[model samples]
Target: MTDYVSTTPGLFPLPDWAKDDLSDLKGHQKHDLISGDEGEEITAAYEQARADVLEVQREADLDRVVEGQLRWDDMLAHPLAVHDAVETRGIVRYYDNNNFYREPVVTGDLEFDGDVAAELETVSELIDDDDDLQAVLPGPYSLFDLATDEHYGDDEEFLAAVGDFLAGELEAFPDHETLFLLEPSLVTDSPAEGLDELASEAIDTVAAATDADVVVQSYWGALEEKVHAHLLDADIDAVGYDFVSNQEDNLYNINEYGTADDISLGLVDGQNTLVEDPEAVRDRTDWVFDQLPVAEFDTVYLTTNTETFYLPYNKFEEKLAVLAEAASLAEVTPA
Candidate 1:
């Protein structure tokens, strides 16, 4: 076991490469890595990219290290994780510009694919050398939201199936500090009812199978009364609170969570290019720490939202350096 101190959360950049050897992973077919049409040319590049990120995280000495999401493999692997017997469809663009995904019409019997299991294990191996490295997975509620219903028919049944399947995946990663990340960009427009219960069941199902800590992340939702009420007794060690994606300057409704859990404070900008001010982040975190206990303050995490639209590969490293400074300061400052 590693001699790690579970005090003070730190910042992590979106898991893409900090310095692109050439350019963005766009234009390349999303499925190329898996099809083997691209072979090790694509696979080797991704592994190297992930290695670079691990080295950077090591140098920064972050409390948590993410295995860089280089191949788009597993970043949003839900499209391939479900059973093919289930129908499939795509989500509508909620905004004038939104990233669209094609997914299964999951109505019943959510099952895990061998691919997702192997992907998570691959990520684990990438960062396994780092003592603080934590593996990530798409949260059940968020996955259910993106998973559409075409032929399967019933929305509620689809959600129930997803819940069941996630329970199985959680069991697969039994011993490591796997941190599941739920991306509910749809929350910006339509956050569902009973999210807390939905999220709790998903986490509990996995917890029964594994010792890993489950973390619920809602990257873009505004934590209004209803959302807060739902999260009040969330059953997990960490609950992600996104000020960056929600565009809130501070943690406004965190107290709504009646339970004391770890708070992942998203401090960097994931959807845009404005590098944040280090001092500003420090002040905002101070305000949030005031709401929770001083001891618990150490449990607060720092990160950008799910993706890195903030900067290109080269510039992202510069931005990460600044956020690192803020996380360091947050440790000494009082709530």
Candidate 2:
């Protein structure tokens, strides 16, 4: 039987109490807090939120837990926008969704000043086992696609710079078992001509910085054949596909080109409120496995199609519970 691991790709919905606390906080206090600086009160609020989020995952008995990314107001651009070298410009729609993020405009040479290390540190303290901790970050290609480059003249140079900056940021992270590099843009807005090779190189650079198993998880849709091919060339443990959104195309790519030993299946719809039944999720897993040329996998991750930030906190928790139960059911299934 294949061992199924239930996990989330981080960026979870904030609980009601945390939302209330943040809403009541002074503007400057909230700014300082999310920007990596902190006051006693704001810090306490963030810590409480993180603790509560971790507890939810523990209750579900998931194999791995994420930091929940409760403080990321701007989503993927939050880390870059907060950096001194990057400027926050006009608002831009985040993919085809109604949500928007302040576009990160690179104005100076990019540098990492402990972007996600603090969040990881707090999470490490909350969990007993270090190996259970998972860190999620925006992939280099996604960051490049979303941002407006001003410092680097050439597109390839900017792409390489983004990769290097992210690698530097990862150097300071606390010990983690897995790293999920969220690369939605690779599917949402495919890379331009001749840039796929550079994009893969950037991904490899970031993957090399951490000892943890890396999964370059893309969402919204599956990549085109060529882009998918280049992505497979990266030195990474696994690749994630959004099965909920583009299942047929994703399966085609996987069956045609083949994938790594391990892969993540986004079995649940993250943006939707209706929770899936565990048996149904298990059935879906079985179907995906049967469709594959090779049914066996080293590890099959049952996760949401995208970050759960769009859903209510209760809904998010329910999805986690479903994934955990589904994984348990799959574990007992015969190979």
- For candidate 2, the TM-score is 0.96
In order of listing, the candidates' clash counts read 4, 0
Per-residue CA lDDT of model 2 for 1-335, tens digit only, reads 46688999899988999888777774657667546576788778888999999999999999899999887778987778788988887989988888889899999999876858888898898789998989999999999998999889889999999999999999899999999999999998898778988999999999999999899999998998988999999999899999999989999999999998799999999999999999999999988888887877788888998999999999999999999999999888844
Which one wins on lDDT? 2
Q: Per-residue alpha-carbon lDDT of model 1 for 1-335, expressed as tens digits?
A: 11112111212233444235313442364476233354445556656666676676566566666655544422354433335545545454422345444455555445665444555566567565534656566555566665565544565555556666666765665245546556454355344666555655654555455565555666665655565555545456666667665644225555433434466766666657677787887787766556544335325666665455334655566556656677777656634
lDDT of 1 at 326: 71
- Give the Å shift of residue 40 in candidate 2: 2.8
Error of 2 at 148 (Å): 1.3
